[model samples]
Target chain A: MEIPYTISTRPDTGLWNAKIGIWLFLASEVMLFGGLFSAYIFLRIDAAPGTWPHGLLNVPVGTMNTAILIMSSVTVVLAWAALKMRRYRAYWWYMLVTILCGVIFLTVKLAYEWPQKFEHFGAYIKPEALWKYEKYLGNQRRAEKGLEPRIEITGHLHSENAKEYEVALDPVNAEPDSPAMDRPHFFPLPVTDKIATIEKEDVERATMFLPTHSAYFASYFTITGLHGLHVLGGVLVFTYMWLPVSKKLYQRNPEHLANRVEVSGLFWHFVDLIWIFVFPLFYLL
Target chain B: MSLKAFHIVFIIFSTLLALGTGAWCVWVDLVEGAPIYLAGAIASFAAAIVLIVYGVWFYRKMKRLRIIT
Candidate 1:
């Protein structure tokens, strides 16, 4: 079947074949994210509904990132528009703005959020400090639910058998009355009762002996860590492309530079779009 | 919007919807511990379908317009 518009051939012009190839590649990228999304769906289903809100994230921070990316998207589109008009100076300016936005986004991510999470990674902080943070989060969640916030208390002990036997954290298994299917058996706790009263100092020993109590912390790190890596990768790629444009290397070969920016823009957009999904999943939801 | 535009918007909107609903499922699972994963899966599947359709349509449109060689 013949396409309606015949391909244009101009010397050093951005070719249709290249554009098509890029689109095809982008489709595959969609599929790549599609797979991550599918895994997320399955895992989400496995989780008990309406119950997994980990309380450490700040929604406003994520929203700010979203706005930054959206604005960058606009700048790049203007850059492309300027290129179409062969307005090289405008192209450089808009593209530079886009690149600057990307840098700012990464800086905020690393400077603020990443360090905070790293501090909670149980690496440098004392056990008491870690416990305090966790309790603080739990209290924050309670407050959000309209309950008067009380001091976060860590009294729940990890079941000894919890290590040998894995409990299904999925809601299906969480049903108090569900037939114990694949239920991880836990060694009887030294402390009696489902809710154990724990002091800040004892929380470390208690949590180490039993880890599932801190599953939220694990999930928090995993999800945000994945996002941070993506931003880092984007920064490297954008920086490489950014230099050539900054020097007006593109003025000599507008189409080539345009093609490079187009490809990079596609990638940058994908990264931002993925974050759109990540923001709510990790922070708001 | 033209058919092509419609498809583009649909794909974008559906993707967003699926993500939103998926987050809701996560929230619900973490809180009420309800059986909402099935619903979330369905929504995401639908979104993926929309995206696939949009991809094919967009590719074809670009080809017709000679935007892609």
Candidate 2:
């Protein structure tokens, strides 16, 4: 049976069936991401003062991913335009580039960003015991002598029990609250390796910079992980359409293929829009 | 909506996002002490300019084909 309005607008809605359906799907997606974004804000405000992490994420890489997603949106539009003009080969190449953008974004997120976080570790130093580890931590207090202290040591760690942890410092001066970290890296500081073996009484908490590390990290992983999945989903859909569906459908009904591409393109644009907000929220502000 | 109309809307929305993100990047660079955000700011503004150019060209191209209103 023929699909009604597959290639034509519905009289009442002035949109094709798939277009309306995709909009409705996108509306639900708005709610989903909206809730997650709200949660991020709530968690961020609820964090202890000056304890929330900033600059822990690679700003340049995040920007690169944002640019990749934006580029993908452009390619998706170009592909749709190509389809409209009956330039099937142009459509094919544009769609492939769109898929590659999604792939590259996911690779940077998974292989580089997530892995770096997992390998890194941090722990809060017990305020009372701060002076005891002065040789290693150097008593560089993050608080302004009145506020609750926010001293965290970051490195690769090995912890066999809740009582103690052994950490070889990551070598990069990752002290977020330290004014020194603000300086751009020009040459490696000629400092010898420092390791800390802390007993439970002197340790407030310790963790790899995973989701469990803090509220900020938990929200970060959840939102970005979901967005990454959306990118992967778009890549799969576009790949399938490019290889099998578009080839067969164009020969039969190029108009239907165009509508399909436009529908997918609409979804692609929405994905890019969400990242525009997500990038500034998590990575910047 | 027609594909042509939606195309215009999409380009406009993307340009707005780039412009907004560019401003945000500037704020982040100045206030947040991250000089790297300047690069993000430059990229976003460039994207906004590119989108505007592309939108104008695409509109004219579509008009030439009598495909858009």
Candidate 3:
């Protein structure tokens, strides 16, 4: 059950086995995320003018998550530093904070963000829908602002029937005549703002912003969902390393334990780096 | 790569992200006139500068460390 090179570097490679293995794993991860990122770029490029969604995510929330991940990265590095200095208690506290950061990030995403998206509804009406649903939209105001006619209304479903659906719209956004909507972006509006009804036949598409909603939602859910899983993985790994059993291992082989922490730290840093790219791509730009 | 080198790369990457996102938020703010984007821009640039200082401190401290059993 003994493994060589866990602590000491290999003569030929000048590195431990775990370091090389983790690099290989991380290389594959890069390609995986790279492919999806490329797809997103193409999708954005291919979208029709003004048809592509923007500003649909909560920028402040997204930025906060970025900060949390960055802080976690710092704590994880500090944890490794403590281990190197033989400060086991300090390492434990730093690792605990790192784990808590990961937990908080996931909690905000699942408990607050995604649920906020789920209960809300959005629909892109059929082209002819304007004829009948004119009063439900603020397109007249949109036109004065030199924007495209309003084809989408995002809010909560007021009611639905065999023939029609009643809904509230213009929710959590600028007032009907407010200048904010004049901007060249779409911000997230996930709430029951104002109410209106629509004939079911008038809608061409509807969604709760799930992955199946549109290209934007699909990319949003898939990429963020995968990233969430990674955060969860980091939490689990750090938790294991912080447990009492790991302390026993550290006491018996301090160098080996330090090397193990280093390896984990490298992976955790990789996770943080990915989020750096993710934040701007998904939230800001 | 050594773990130290990897950590350096992470810090460097984080710096770049902060700078790039800051520039982007500025652009978005110009177009949308939203105060939140303005706030984002300021925060990002601050984070970038802080990371630069932190990276240097980390480098100096880590360079001499050697794990002893």
Candidate 4:
């Protein structure tokens, strides 16, 4: 049975069936993202001063991904326009580029950005020993480059008896299982000729700024992860449309093919729209 | 109203709302020196501009094809 109004507009709605359907779906998508965005605003406003993490995300990398998505949006629209003009080959090329852009965006997010966040460890230190730890880190940097350690602890270093000890941190390592695998042992700080071990007890808090780390991260992951899923969906749909099945439809009824591309393009643009908000909210702010 | 007219109007209104909100966020970021507001501002503003350009182009193309009067 053929579906009516697939190619032509209905009298009441003044839009084709698929067009109205996509608009309705996009309306719901707006509400979904709107709620998450509201949560982000509340979390940011309520966060304590100086507690929220900043300079955590790499701005240049985020900007690159933003550009990729924006370009994909244009290509998707052009793909639809190509189909409208009955240019099948041009449509295929534009859709291919759109899918490739989505692939690259996801690749950068999972391979680079997400892993970088997991590798960074934050340690909270006791108030009294903060200055000592700072001095030790400064001297450690100099000593690593073959300079003499300027600062020395002269007294009977109150080894294990002291309650207030400074938080010492380690730089992010390339090892896959590091920090996590070595959690039970002391946190190894880079000191000259000696492995300075910071026991877990002395450190007030130790954690990576993962989604579980704070409310800021919780909202960040939720919003962006959902947006990523939307991109993945577009990639799958466009891939299928570029295949032979859609070619068959193109030969039989080109208008049907064009309509499908238009619908998909609408969804694709909506995805790009969401990312426009997501990029700046997570990366810049 | 015609579908084309409705769509064009909707796009224009949405773009304006996005730009207004984005500008306000940027202003807040400048005053407060907060990262979140700045990020939101930039993204919203970019989205608005892209949609505006695309909407205008789509409208012109449709008119040329006699898809909308």
Candidate 5:
């Protein structure tokens, strides 16, 4: 049996069936994202001042991804408009650009941004050894430039697991290009400059910040990961729409193809819309 | 009123609500010295503004063409 309203508007709603269906799906999607956003708010509010991580994400990279997604949204709309005007070639070109943008956005996110977070480890130093560690970093910086070491404080690195080991206060190969080195002083030693072998009892806790490290990370992974999945889904759908099957449909009924593009375009817009919020909330202020 | 016109109006109203809520949250965050909700709120406001402008433009174009009358 032929489905009604696939190419024309229904009498009651005055919208094609798929258009109504997409809107309903998008409404549910909004609610899903809304609840997660609420959870993010709650976590941020409950976090203690100075405990919430800031300036951890690379802002420039995130801004690039945001621009990419926004541009893709434009292409999506153009693709749909081209289809409506019966410009099949233009429609395909726009759709291909949209898909490419999605692919690039995901690549930057997973390849560059996420790995930086994973490679970073944070160690909680004991109050007594904290000052010594600062001095060690200073000495190490001078030594790296061929200058004489100033002062060395040797101590055992204490991890949160209660494991203690006598280790040098020297910069280890653990973290290269550590962001913490630029800051005055902070927890989770970005790098160790020089080895100062000291007693094992002087250290506090050492921990690596994985996704399980803090509430902030947990929410970050959850929200961004979900968004990534959505991007992937959009790319796949657009690719399928660009396939010969859709072309055959277009030949049979151009309006049906146009409606398909419109429905997909609506979804693509929503994906971009979510990223607009995600970019600022995750990367910027 | 026509269903199409009603849909457009509903979207406009929703956009306005998003803009208002986003602005309010941002103001609160500024006063409170960086609340978690502020970032999302600001983003939502920005996105809402873009969407509102686009929607209004599309509405006008449709009206001019008698597509949504």
Candidate 6:
């Protein structure tokens, strides 16, 4: 089930060399992300529902980045089309615009989004924070035990052959202010406060994965982190191509620069494509 | 449109489909914070399938015209 390879020795021109190289590069990138995503799927299944820590992300900000990347893809295609039309001036302007979009995307992610993550990471990794979390949980459990009022009943818990029942209390004998249902807001609600407080023991159990949360957070960071790196690399590539050196190269063989842009654009589009997969799996699921 | 232009349009449309759907996924997850219908996932998967089909179709068309090897 493989596509047959064809060779072309056409003056190192046409789309042959650059197209093949980009396709191969994309294939390797597929394996890199594929492995990470597969790990995410397995961990997701292994972990219980609502326990994967999916609530840590800021959705609105991520959505904006998505729009920016899509728009950049449009600009890149326009730039490539300008080249096909042999309109060098239009091609340069569009390419510069596309590169600018990439810069904005990376700046937003690193300067804004990444710092928050670092702050959260600092809180999670601190031994003091873990100690505080434990103390809070202990207090909640103690509160639960203390809060429940003791009551003396004429009829008590009765069991026969593994069957158990509590005798119905007479209204006259019953305590008017029973505290059986008193719930204390203890254990410092799951960092996000998105979900309700679970049992003290469950909180401790979940805390084992605390330092970094779950595989979901791991994948979230790894995928986006790698994508960010790609964006940076792309900016550098475009910068070099837009520089005087690239202009000199283009003056000699203009098609070389065009081919270079085509390859870079392909990689940029692939980065956008991976985000398509990452957004859903991380933010939605 | 010529084949080249058609190819460009297909790629852009498919990419937009992927991005819009991907953003929707992030929005839903942020709002709901749990899995539901996953409309964004559905959209991206559909876009990926279409992109692949279009890629193959474009490649074949180019080959037939001897524009590409």
Best-matching candidate per TM-score: 3
Candidate 2, B1-69: lDDT as tens digits: 555676677778778878887897788678656676788789889989999999899888878876556
Candidate 3 segments exceeding 4 Å error = A136-146, A171-177, A184-193, B34-36, B64-69
Candidate 3 global lDDT = 0.80
Question: Model 3, A6-32: lDDT tens per residue?
Answer: 878899998889989988999999999
Interface RMSD of 6: 5.1
Question: TM-scores across all candidates?
Answer: 0.53, 0.85, 0.91, 0.69, 0.67, 0.59
Residue A156, model 2: Cα distance from true site in angstroms: 1.8
lDDT: worst 10-residue window of model 2 chain A: A183-192
For candidate 4, please provide the TM-score of chain A on its own.
0.77
Write one digit per residue (lDDT tens) for candidate 4, span B1-69.
Answer: 333454465566557656865776677667656687678788879878888888889789877976547
lDDT of 2 at A211: 92
lDDT of each: 0.51, 0.78, 0.80, 0.68, 0.67, 0.57
Backbone collisions counted per model:
23, 0, 2, 3, 15, 0
Candidate 1 off by > 4 Å? A1-17, A48-51, A121-223, A244-249, B1-69
When only chain A is evaluated, what TM-score does every model earn? 0.59, 0.88, 0.93, 0.77, 0.77, 0.65
lDDT of 1 at A12: 56
List, residue by residue over B1-69, the lDDT tens digit for candidate 1.
122333344347446645565565555455544454446546555655665665576557555755324
Please give the lDDT score at residue B35 for candidate 5. Answer: 55
User: Model 6 misses residue A147 by how many Å?
Assistant: 23
Candidate 4, position A82, lDDT: 80
What are the iRMS values of all candidates?
A: 6.7, 2.6, 1.8, 5.5, 6.9, 5.1
Candidate 3, number of clashes: 2
DockQ scores for all the models shown? 0.07, 0.38, 0.65, 0.08, 0.07, 0.11
- By TM-score, rank the candidates, best first: 3, 2, 4, 5, 6, 1
Using lDDT, rank the candidates from best to worst: 3, 2, 4, 5, 6, 1
Cα deviation of B66, candidate 1, in Å: 14
lDDT tens digits by residue: candidate 1, A1-285: 954212353355444455555567768867876776666656656855333334345544665676677567656655655665667778778877887887788788779766644432121123345444442234344445554332222222233342321111222112323323112211111222343323334333323211232455455555556656766676676576666644465656666666656656666666666776776665654
